[model samples]
Target chain A: MRAEETMNKLPANPERATLEGKNKFLGFWFFLGGETVLFASLFGVYLGLRKATNGGVTSQELFELPLVFIATMLLLTSSLTAVFATMSLKSQNFKAMIGWLVITVILGFSFLGLEIYEFNHYVHEYEHTIRSSAWGSAFYTLVGTHGAHVLFGVSWITLLIVRNFGRGLNLYNAPKFYVAALYWHFVDVVWVFIFTVVYLMGKVG
Target chain B: MGSHQNDSVSKHDQSHLDIHHKIAHQKELKQHIVSFAMMIFLTMLSFIAVASEAISTRFAILFILVLAGIQAAFQLYIWMHLSHKGHQYPTWGIFFGIGVAATCVAAGAAMIW
Candidate 1:
């Protein structure tokens, strides 16, 4: 009777029930706030130095709109997939949530792969190494940091799936999945800026 | 007698949960689909503005930046559900981050290269 009562009292969002989960939720937001500052600084630097190419290949010569546009679509769609997974979690469908999360991770990996190819092509084709010019250095460091976040997100979600496989949607596991989805969406937010401030502005300027 | 009462109580809880969840699912489904479609449209519009020469260079930059801002807002409020109830603190957290970020942009602009 007691166990059933506890189960019966489970809120729609089982994730936010416990104190620990609430703390995790709020603390993670603070961390993301700090990340916002970090990225902002990098962005400012990239803006300041993007034109100081020291006579190397210019950003205009290197950026292809079609490729960057496709990558942007991939990450944006992944954000929506993560949203679906969160909805599934709220609706108490663990299987469907996990399925959507798997799709999110795959899209993340694809974005990372495209980024790697983009950087390699620039370095080889235009001799745009970080050491080549001030512009090159700012460009790589700023965009590379965002790519690293994507790699980290993909790995984090993969580990969560592996560790929680066969585990039902209990309160403990619910918060874990919820925060991972949060982190994935945060990564998507950063990418929206990257494609805008970095790629789009680079093309325009 | 005790066991029979327990059985009835559990059944009642199940029925209540089913009704509640069904309504919520419908509302959330519409929210997600609408936001997703809007975000995609905004993205395509920005891309087109940049690709086409109908707009001047400076206007295009401002136009796309505004689009990006709106898209980010959609991702935060809709996809991340920050607009939902009981999200007061996290909302503060993100806005605080944005405040600091805006300051950084200002400082960086003033510093110049």
Candidate 2:
């Protein structure tokens, strides 16, 4: 009888509780930092090679400020939805949290769709393919990397939502939800830079 | 002695989960919503800045980039919860990584420039 009670009340395995979760959290943050540098390098390359447009489509001519601005707004709002989901998690409101996450995923998908259409429009309409010039290559590389990050975030969140739909909130799943929200925020941060460096700066310079 | 006893009693009370804590959490959620609204407004302002013909292109670019930087900081600190956490080591690690990346980008640019 004593053994049964002890087993029931055993503190959550520290390996799973503090150590492993903390390691995953810290490692993910480091990974995001690495991503920042990856993006910074691409931005630098894009800046230098920006003028080597080979007299093809130029930033001033090709970039449409209005469409990019709308896309930016959509992504920024989705970041907020993810925040609400995290808040729900903190309050142990599992249903509310899941609801917010689903909303975030939808917003993310819309943003991705818009980006795909924008890229296609630019390439087909403006004759600005990635293979056109150094500028085109750098442009696609930097912005494409960001798009890939968004796609990854969407997939990550979707899987987490489906996996946890029936599990409910417990110590085991709380950290998973938390990490997914972290990834969503990281993607938002990257979009912030992409808007500034690629869209805003391109139009200006 | 009596006050010390009261302090311990209150501490015990604080340890117990209650509805007040949930209410406070909801209030915090409202603050988060307000922050999000502010960010949305700022994003729209940037769009206006970009679309307007009167604004000098150079100033428009600088304004938008600076605004994006501010928005990024807001998302990281508020939404990501990095600011409240003990993030000193992580901050240093990421910044150092950025430094190395900057060097690589500079070198690559120089080679191709």
Candidate 3:
């Protein structure tokens, strides 16, 4: 009876209230740590081979500021929405949490759409296929890996929302949402570097 | 009988704590908005530094890199809650990864020339 009563009223940090939740939180961060290294190596490779364009096109010619800026804004806003969702989850406002997450999912989709369009434009208009040049190979591999992460995040969150629609918020599902949001934010963090090192620097040179 | 009475008292206290938690959450909401705004401003600054002809290429590169570092800090600390309590292990784990990553980048870049 006591446990049931306490369960109904969320603890201060519902995401870390249970042993399982705490484990998930710690484990996910470690996973993100590994992911950072993975991306860093790819970044290193891209930076090394960025100048080898093989006479097709260069970074300055192929990358556009406008499209990248729009995509960055979309992903950044989605990260904020995910934060809001986590906040609502803490306050035990089930509907508010879901509302924020739905908005996040929408923003994620918009960002992905923009990326797909950007890649399509690059391939068709610029002839910048991965096989075209060493620079192209490195660029696509690095950015494409990041894109794959975005796709994974979008799919993960959508499944979470669907699977738990009937169940509402509970301890079992709270950590799931919290960890997913963290993953989403990490993806945004990677993009922050991508835009800077890949896009802006490419433009400058 | 005594246990039942104590339970009631704790329940009363729990309700009091809930109010405080809500107030704290409201404050955190403001922090989130401020951080987001700051990130947007920094991004624009980086873009302008590159887009304008006034800034030299070498300087623009350095300036934008510094801005990116600042923005990444905001995302990690504020948005990702790395500054919050109970994140000590996370701090260690991520930093270690960053250390390895920096080495990898240095090695890869050095191979070019």
Candidate 4:
């Protein structure tokens, strides 16, 4: 029984307690680093074309602070929940970790719902489609890419939870969960910039 | 490589390691709480800076962008544990990636003119 307990409950760094775990952990961070550059390039393009609105609705006219604010709060809170999930993972509390992760997924879905609503509102009310202007293209590409990322993250986490439902937290699976949590946080980090650069900056003019 | 062997090591060895891990976890938990509060506050402050009209719009944009930077750093280091020990390679990978990102952003910006 003691040996069984030991097998499951590894160390605080359960994700990196083995050589394979170490590789996965390091590789994921490096992947995140690469992702950083990918997003940065998009941001650069968006900044350059933010004002070329081709006689359609301008950002200042379209962006409503309240909706964006609610979205930000939802995502920010979700990031915190993911952190809680990671903490629970460290302590080997499988149920609590899943509980927190589920909350994280819920918040992510809420944010995605708001984003979809925001996009639909803009399209129907203002006809602000991607082809409307250069500004429109940049805006959609940058924010849309981010929206795609959120979609991917939600799918990723939900699948992990479902797939691992039968298997308790073990050495093989902890790294996967840890990296998923990291990716979720990275998603939040990206949104921090998007809200600041895209939404908040767009509202300024 | 032999994590299985490591796992099979005597229970005495693990209990010894567990004490240190418990202490480290306590510290990490406190850090998470403090950073979460700080992040919320920063987000609020950025929004307030924009809504207040106390500053020029351009200045508010710049100010909030800087706040975003700080928030990202906090998330990366504290929440992601990028600053933790044994992360030296990840540290290099990220900073090098940042260097490339900076160059990419700058190169893209120059095409604006």
lDDT of 4 by residue, A1-205 (tens): 3564646556556898778989999999899889989998988888888888999999999999999999999999999999999999988999999999999999999999999999999999999999999988888898999999999999999999999988888889999999999999999998999999888888887
| C-alpha local distance difference test of each model | 0.85, 0.77, 0.90, 0.88
Q: Please list the residue runs of candidate 4 whose C-alpha ends up more than 4 Å from where it truly belongs after superposition.
A: A1-8, B1-19
Task: Residues A107-166, candidate 3: write the lDDT tens digits.
Answer: 999998999999999999989999999999999999999999999999999999999998
Question: What's each prediction's clash count?
Answer: 0, 0, 0, 0
Worst 10 residues of 2 chain A by lDDT: A7-16
TM-score of each: 0.94, 0.85, 0.95, 0.93
Model 2 spans > 4 angstroms off: A1-17, B1-16, B98-112
Candidate 4 on B57-92: residue-level lDDT in tens?
Answer: 988988998899999999999999888778899889
Q: Local error of candidate 3 at B57, Å? A: 0.7
* Worst ten in a row by lDDT for model 1 chain A: A1-10
Clashing pairs in 3: none
lDDT string, candidate 2, A1-205, tens digits: 2332332221222112456666776787788788778877887788788888988988889888878877987888889899999887766678999999999999999999999999999888999989999999998998898899889889989999999899787656777887888888888888887787777777767
lDDT of 1: 0.85
Q: Which has the greatest TM-score? A: 3
What ranking emerges by lDDT with the best candidate at the front?
Answer: 3, 4, 1, 2
RMSD list, candidates in order: 3.6, 5.3, 3.0, 2.6
Every model's DockQ, to 2 decimals? 0.44, 0.38, 0.54, 0.53
Q: Return the number of clashes found in candidate 4.
A: 0
Model 1: CA > 4 A from native: A1-9, B1-10
Top candidate, metric DockQ: 3
